[model samples]
Target: MPQPVLSLDALRALDAIARKGSFAAAAEALYKVPSALSYTIAKLEQDLGVQLFDRSRQRAQLTSAGLLLLEQGRELLQASQRLEEQVRQLDSGWEQRLRIVVDTIMPWAPLWQLSADFTALERFTRLQFSEQVMAGTWEALLRDRCDMALGLAGEGVNAQVELHLLGYAEFAFAVPPTHPLAQRVATTPDEPVRREELLAFTAVVVADSAAEMPGRDSGLFAAGHVLQVPTMQAKIAAQLAGIGVGFLPVHLIQQELLTQQLVVLTTEIPRAPVPLYLGWRKDVVTGQACRWWREHLLNLPWQQLLTPGELKAHV
Candidate 1:
């Protein structure tokens, strides 16, 4: 006899039974009778010339061959679903991709969750993310490098660009436990440490991501040695290694602070929380994906969203 052609229905029946752990449960989930599911499974096994189930057990149990088929069948089913979703996405007028620029200081825990949710929608809109610092986020938008930006400085507000207030990020002055500043803070926490002492150590600063636009130097001092790193994570690592000392976002180093890996020092110049903004060009026509992001970000609670430790738990 010619080999029987397999169908999605048969594969689906097998997967459901394996996942649900019993024929009765699988039948209920598929909204079919127990006998119907059993028939499908039996037909599939016969077509493949294999005994799929060991019927001697009280509960439906798969044989070795049955488990192999079940594993492969689940993968096939997922691919089939993706194929259908891509078709639907083509039918809709969704954008092919979205480019988002996120500032280095922006907490990424919530953004990661947002990306996961977007993927679940199966809109087929590819998300491209790039990291920037300070002015670089704004420069990306102005250079037409990104569709949207988060944690941008408020300077040079464009009339054609829409801005959303994302609240302030508190910057804490931190150094490794072995750093000179950490050792010098013998007095009460309220008393200001000399600025000259702070200027003595090298400061770890993140390089701006801007290309054409003039980059910014936010925390650098004239007298101090400068260690310019490419990213915020690098700066964090550098500070932890006692390479330099600088202000870091409290949200990003909560764990370090709690573990005593980094010590907060009293400074004559206390860095205030920096206010960040979300921005996108208003003149350009936006696709559904862009609109979705704008709507979500505009309404997001900045304080809760930017708190890394709090958001990481839920993610």
Candidate 2:
């Protein structure tokens, strides 16, 4: 019996044809003549003893076998690229890629600014951003799927992971400008309702465990109607729809506040802001880009995010 030989070039040609949807398009992308591409596919079909594509239409459509082969081809190609990247990093003496996993609830402006600055240095650095729930983001770092994570500290984060306190993000109850809460006086209203009073009405909260405001454990949330939502955007939408009062980051709702779409609750509820931290594996030495970002985040003037009293408490 004779063993069959594998044809990598033919496989590449088939992969390109499947991706581009036509021999002409694949040829153009691969910088090969259409005849050459067709020949490669023909050879591939012969070697596999199966029809890879249906030729009835002007465009190429993958047969069942072709679809399976294309899926496997993509996985193989990705693995090959990862191997090549690792080898290239070894040769260069430093890995230039920075993989970051962050909580979806964090403010976007600072993060975007940091990313722009890092890439502007032109240091061969690549940035990968993974937006996940709080616990999910920490899991990514612990599993070695990401280099760092930004979110609240969580249980089960590995001992090897170092936590850097970035600052605190205060949580506030926001309502529409015409809501009754806005009509109340700012200085502790007479007969002030407890924090849980808002929950007597509909309370829209970030459904994800990671994005939830801290201090929820306080008795204020014990007996109230609660609606769980997945993202900040969804929570805002629900609030705008008058579904319920929502706990949201002040920065996220600044535009809404300015537009009079939302107003802060003046009830005597305890205000507990969440502490933000940047976590990374302590054993792993950070790259130049990651280190630069860590320093920048640490030095940010948090006073912008805190009120005078809150700033005094933090200091």
Candidate 3:
């Protein structure tokens, strides 16, 4: 890789000059002589062959090139400062970074609150969240793509991960009230919907986000056509639009059920509640930050809807 022509010192000097609005003032703020700051800028300009400042002006003002550098340079400065802080705080047993993968079926509003609560601890661990589907959630930990996973299915339990049963999410076969299936359920009221009759309709299913592993889907009962959506929201939207029919998380569609926009139909063969899991890599030693997250998140409503009742105490 080519060596950078501009150093951190050069960026700092440029930033200070721009912010302080004068070489003398910037030098004072930096605890250096005015000429020292001048020499640093001059050296940077010489190496890059760019006129960083307009000397023709009475007061020190940056040229167009200098303004662009300052724009990107400030971001670099903030990143460097954060890196320094993380390095300094590493002895506290907090990870420098924490990557979490959540299944798309889980509600995200609670997770956002969980992240905010983590930030309040000020551990200097950078938190990242990714939403995956089915096998994709499990593979994230297997591939070491993320530090921890929430809503992993119990199908592929391995030595690589330590998992906890988050809980079972009850699913219902919901379709828009205008749908033929809904009308059929309304007419019969007592008889369970036959699986063979469902074979003629389209089923909306959440597509597994697995990149390397084989993708798998759930709650599909031999629908003649399949419409795979990226997330639960899309699946819900598809069902609400009367375009397809499939099982959906009961908790997620409470409002639709209450409003009569969507109605749940009894099936001849009912889908068992799906088990969701919380998992992390077993190979690596966990840090305080990881443990902290594990504790807080387990208490939040991953097992239930994105409710505030449990999340408030943790937050």
Give the TM-scores of the predictions, in the order they appear.
Answer: 0.69, 0.59, 0.76
| C-alpha RMSD for every candidate | 7.9, 8.7, 5.8
**Deviation in angstroms for 235 in model 2?**
1.8
**Residue 282 in model 1: lDDT:** 84
Find the 10 residues in a row with the least total lDDT in model 3.
Answer: 306-315
Q: Which stretches of candidate 2 lie over 4 Å from their true place?
A: 1-90, 93-96, 153-158, 180-191, 209-220, 302-315
lDDT sort, best first? 3, 1, 2
lDDT of 1 by residue, 38-104 (tens): 8888888878889989989787578999889888888989999987887777568678789999988
What lDDT is obtained when candidate 1 is compared to the true structure? 0.80
Task: State the lDDT of candidate 3 residue by residue for 121-145, as single tens digits.
Answer: 8778888888899889888889998
Which order, best to worst by TM-score? 3, 1, 2
lDDT digits (tens) for residues 1-315 of candidate 2? 867644657667877887787789889989999999888888778877998889898766899998898888777777777777766764665456789887766766778877887768655567888776656666677678788887644443457788877666666667776555555434444545466566567777664443333323211243367777766677788888787775666666777777777766644664666666788898877666677777887777644643223211000
What's the lDDT for candidate 2?
0.68
Off-target runs (Cα >4 Å) in candidate 1 are 1-91, 187-190, 305-315
lDDT of 3 at 182: 72
Per-residue lDDT of 215 in model 3: 86
